[model samples]
Target: MPMKVRGAPQAVVAILAFAGIVVALMQTMMIPLIPQLPRLLHATPSDATWAITATLLTGAVATPVVGRLGDMYGKRRMLLIGLALLVLGSFIGALSGTLAPMVVGRSLQGLAMGVIPLGISVMRDVLPADRLGSATALMSASLGVGGALGLPAAALVAERADWHLLFWTAAGFGVLAMALVLAVVPESQVRGGGRFDVVGAAGLSAGLSCLLLAVSKGVDWGGQVTAGLLGTSAILLGLWGWWELRTGEPLVDLRTSARRQVLLTNLASAVFGFGMFAMTMVLPQLLQLPRSTGYGLGTTMLGVGLTLAPSGLVMMAMSPVSARISRARGPKVTLMAGALVVAAGYGLGVLMMSALWQLVFVSSVIGAGIGLAYGAMPALIMSAVPIGETAAANSLNTLMRAIGTSISSAVAGVILANLTNAAGLPTLDGFRLVMAIGGGASLVAIAIAAFLPAHRVPAGTLPGREPSARRAVRISARPRPAERAGLPGEDE
Candidate 1:
């Protein structure tokens, strides 16, 4: 059972969500600085990218590791550690005038990426069942919310002030959020106490690092290096999977992850992540390209940021709507509906991009779909897994989404690079192709979601209650029959 907390539930949700937004803001804070990093940090363009790549690689590795650690230790405790890393990273970044230290600070910021999934897990372990749906929905939406809002905020800062001030602002927000978490958020009493899986952690890290590095940098690194990295990743991951099955206490329990609902939800998450990121990649470039190109909107970075900001607000606004849909028809239906909406959004982008308003409309539709899909994902995962494995399970799902986005970034880069015009800039056709591909990927997610087992209300629950609502209550209540015999050594 979830531990009852003395603090108001609303305060807990707000603090955790704020922490999520701050970390997400850090991810995008450097976006406006990307083009300037070469000059500012005294590095070549190629070398400067490591500052961004460092964060991506570390975040991919950290989500699962810190999630497992959060489960073994306390989620709130681990969350504080993540926030501290963010603050420390921001401070270092503020002080750095060189590429090496900047990359180090960015890597530390990436380590805090586990905060979102950890926050969802914390909510699962403390909030009242009545509040879980909308609360988790909002928490999941925070990733998009922060990214959307961060771009405009970062853009304005980058345009008007010394870039160092951006990091200072991030540090200030981190400190405030950290203090609020300490004051308002309650530590989950639930614990999966066991010795840390050192070898498992190392193997998983090596595998993910290899895979993400190859995918993200393959365009710059050439075919041979990319192929070599990919092959190594495959071998490392294969061995890691084998070890996980045989080990007494694994970092991720393959058996639980293999459950039909968990399996399908993860597959859908990857496809959805890929589809969602394709929009981000295509939109800004289209917006910022010169209007002489006929297809370009001829806008500044700040304009691009302002245009996309509404989509973020729409995503947050859709949380309650997503929760209601999940409660009415089950998360399965919500996921399918969300995927279809995303596909429609991309379809609109491909068909109508001559005006800024059209792009905003396209993005807002996609963002709404993302909010719904993201919100439903945790409900699907948490419903399937044991309470003890909430953090690890959610972390794994988060990792899958990251992998999807990385793959999307690589594929979109290839498309945009190869299909350029006379000026060596990506043409309108390439942009449309990318949007069409995003639509196709969303369609694929719909197919995968179709395979998820229908949500079933627990036996002995009141029949009068909505099945999804009853299911949420059961998820927060005592273990169901399926979860009673969960992974070996799980606490009851």
Candidate 2:
């Protein structure tokens, strides 16, 4: 099709959505290979765990930094850089046959986690005001989409082919996404004009690394180390906060983030992340547990993957519904609704986890909730902050979710490790306990979201929400930084 005739906006949404999915795939791609890591990499089990930890730490650090970079420079440019990192990491991981290089590669792959936020930021820049909500919703939901879709496929590849193919396949998708982005996506003109905050970045990275390290590794490392790490993290983060408030170009705007809308949303996002990850962590183990254990389903990895795949598809399907809900009831309402749905899902999981069909039903219900809340988050954040800060703000929200999940996993691990049946198998009660915690987290999310200030970005201000001429003045009163900077407005 000729360039003029092409539906460029639609194409941009599709490409960016696909890119988000591709990056998310990296998160769960290692799930199937985790057990085999010690043997495959000729490393100790403890050491092999770094393959997972490396990604978590780097992702936590990279998210805010990448967001700041995207704000200062261009979202599209940072997005491509993130994709290139994934490609490079995937290639290195594909070629690695041992532990050290594998950790290095996986850490590199983690940097790409920022792609989803950057993509959402770009949509704000380049997409029409009318298409923004749904487009951004779909992009946000891609985190769940790739994660859900990746597990079964990765299980299949891990079982049927060489393990190296997993990373190779990831690399292949990365390359394709990069090509599509470069070909069709234009550089966003909107920029947060400022110098990069190196001090802020380094400080945030250090604090987060210590904080997450404590949370994620506490189960393995025991009490004293965990407590010390936690204490150290608290100190460093306290200092980091002090510096951020005083700095000119901070990695995260603490004051803006402290606003009622942004603060509550981040808190809710964290709880939602924890709640959503509960089903994911528990279901697989329950499905793959030995049938002799009575409560265990005694299935293979592929069986577990297949049983859980519907949740991801459900998430993708529900994104538009979520967007519609946000449009009608407002994003805060959508978020609260999603939290309730997730709580209901976890409640059901607590009640009916013995059967495969039951697990599938429960997961899908939670997926629907995730789709709704995830879709609303960017809308809430974008409306609260200036156009220039969207990427950084979204990145911080994404980091909050990551922190939630990391903490959730650690908490679940501790519970499961200590509470077991006579056969040493994790008992049904323990699983229910996790579900209860998940449900509780969702309730907390609802409480936080309920307190968010009542406001909506008008149509035309938001990509999809087009206010009428009468209302446009009120919406457009605060011109985007691009307009003030005297650059020709490209989209928003």
Top model by lDDT, which number?
1
All models: lDDT?
0.87, 0.86
Global Cα lDDT for candidate 1: 0.87
The deviation in Å at residue 120 for candidate 1 is 0.3
lDDT of 1 at 235: 98
Clashes of each: 0, 10
| Cα lDDT, model 2, residue 302 | 92
C-alpha lDDT of residue 444 in model 1: 100
> Every model's Cα RMSD, please?
4.0, 4.5
Predicted structure 1, TM vs. truth: 0.94
Error of 1 at 317 (Å): 0.6
Best by TM-score: 1
Off by over 4 Å in 2: 1-7, 456-492
Query: Per-residue lDDT tens digits of candidate 2, residues 1-492?
Result: 111212478999999999999999998899998889899999998889999999999999999999988887788899999999999999999999999999999999999999999999888767766677889999999999999999999999999999999999999999999999999887776677777878888888988998998998886788899999999888989998999888766778887787677888899999889888888779999999998988999999999889989999999998888778777767888899999999999999999987889999999999999999999999888877766777999999999999999999988988898899887778889999999999999999999988886644454345223323112111212233334332111112
